[model samples]
Target: MEPHLVTDERLRRVLDDLIRREPLFHRPEFGTTRADFAAMTASDFWETGASEQRYDRAYVLDALEERHQDPPVEEWETSEFSCRELAADVYLLTYTLVLDGRMSRRATIWQQDPDGWKVVYHQGTVVQGS
Candidate 1:
């Protein structure tokens, strides 16, 4: 691990907490309904998809609802998690995700709110030649 990837004890806990939620919106354990998804995200949440297209909260939520209507079976492996605090109660989490042999680098900005963790933003870039 590089020095920059090393997190302090306090951040380590945050890292672990956020890791389980990585590749966010995929974990039914955290949320499955559109309303649940909405609660997990900030009002202005947005994301850059692996397709390099930017989507806003409304579009993303609608898409999520449609997808979960008949969710496809996906098996993904996540690793190389690293986290850094960007500001008070806010953190950036980065990791690699491998699904069906295709790999992508994922990053999610999360904020610790009174309710729970809320996603501020998220993005996924497919790794070339993976």
Candidate 2:
């Protein structure tokens, strides 16, 4: 396999790690704090949710907090992991999330910082059925 392909597989593993550890970061009862999000995202990050758009890191944190306040949805399957290197140590990871028998397209950009990989942006668009 080519070197970039190898790197992509490795990055895919990182995403897998995130999903497998959702009880830590994405669960409500775990009580993930805003400071934890601050550490996970870039300073200027933004994200699009199922119903709202947050244009900066603070707004993103607010959105996350709001979501965490609600009961968690633990039944979801993620597939189609694709990664593209955007720049040195920056990459885009895209996948499909299926929940409630509905699909959503999701994308997240991760930047490799000195501390670790921080998500700089993310978007999740619901796939409407005909």
Whole-model Cα lDDT of every candidate shown, in order: 0.91, 0.68
Clashes in each model (backbone N, CA, C under 3 Å)? 0, 0
Model 2, 19-67: lDDT tens digits are 5433224544434678777787788888777676557778767867777
Where model 2 places Cα greater than 4 Å from the true spot, the runs are: 1-31, 52-54
Model 1, which residues run further than 4 Å from truth? Answer: 1-4
Error of 2 at 57 (Å): 1.9
Candidate 1 per-residue C-alpha lDDT over 80-126 given as tens digits, one digit per residue, 9 for 90 to 100:
89899999999999988997778998889999999999999999999
**Candidate 1 global lDDT:** 0.91
Pairs of residues at least 3 apart in sequence or in different chains that clash in candidate 1: none
TM-score of each: 0.93, 0.71
Worst 10 residues of 2 by lDDT: 21-30
- lDDT at residue 129 of model 2 (Cα atoms): 36
